[model samples]
Target: MCIGVFKKENFEIVNNPKDAEIIIINTCGFIESAKEEAINCILEMAELKQTANCKYLIAMGCLVQRYKDDLIKALPEVDLFLSIDEYDNLWEKVAKLIKVEIKSKNTLDYMDRIISTGNATAYLKIAEGCSNRCTYCAIPYIRGPFVSRKMEDILEEAKKLASSRN
Candidate 1:
């Protein structure tokens, strides 16, 4: 049950995150409480961004991705918003914020060199978007139809990650 042991330490797990130039907040939008938590986290990070010299507050995960425009209108502090689909090129956006040139034919190639917390752990994202039409749900609308990534590409990324680190 210890999921933390399986997680990758990509975030600045620190008391003071304002020291970092870029902040990536992976939020939850599954339920009301979760949404509130994500909002509060975003607002807190936004405040940190204001006074801590945090140049960019990149908001990813389900909250912003599911509620794209609404989240944008509510929080103007977030510099970039993306979903699970955008995680593939996540480093690129992060690099752009820091003014670092990630010259790679494929971002995965660059990511292979990046040190991950685990040698056996890899975030294998299979696909993105959804088409389930629920009257109260906006996921289908926000993400459009489900678009499956080619198996070859995914396998390649997995192979790279597997070969590199956890």
Candidate 2:
């Protein structure tokens, strides 16, 4: 939904992180390996700030919320870290960093999504975090409780997803 959210604010979502002026990695830190992978991914994407078109290196999602302090100290390359809760204000923060005026603020009706995955497949995240208390998992603590998105929004997104093929 990050794509949908940012697109609402008129931000372009490019195919390559190298081509993007703003690169946001919405991560999942459910498990140890996932956390490791998320960190590795951050390190990987952080490289684009120098070699690529990336200017705003943002790390958002479970990892940010869970380990905000440590990651801030560890990864100085990351321009900013947005926790799962802070996603609602993503465009505002980015706009300030990029020095661009927001065309339409407070509109969450964006359904246009850039197909990032290979082939025709796409991943649409309907909800974030997990509420369930799985003893072995960190999603609840890291990502917070699971909340279902509004049914209307989900249907609208689905419609747009189908229409994109046409």
- What digit string (tens of lDDT, one per residue) describes model 1 on residues 50-107? 7886888888787876787898888888888877566667666656666766665233
On residues 1-166, what C-alpha lDDT tens digit does candidate 2 reach at each position?
A: 5677776666677777778988888777667888899999999998768898777788888878888899999999998898867766777877777788876664234465556665466566688668888888766787668888788888887777776753
Q: Whole-model lDDT for model 1 versus the true structure?
A: 0.68
lDDT of each: 0.68, 0.76
Best by TM-score: 2
What's every prediction's RMSD, in angstroms? 6.6, 2.9
TM value for model 2: 0.78
- TM-scores for all candidates: the values are 0.59, 0.78
Best-performing candidate as measured by lDDT: 2
Kindly report which residue pairs in candidate 1 clash with one another.
118-166, 119-166
Q: Which ten residues in a row have the lowest lDDT in candidate 2?
A: 106-115
Q: List the residue pairs that clash in candidate 2.
A: 131-146
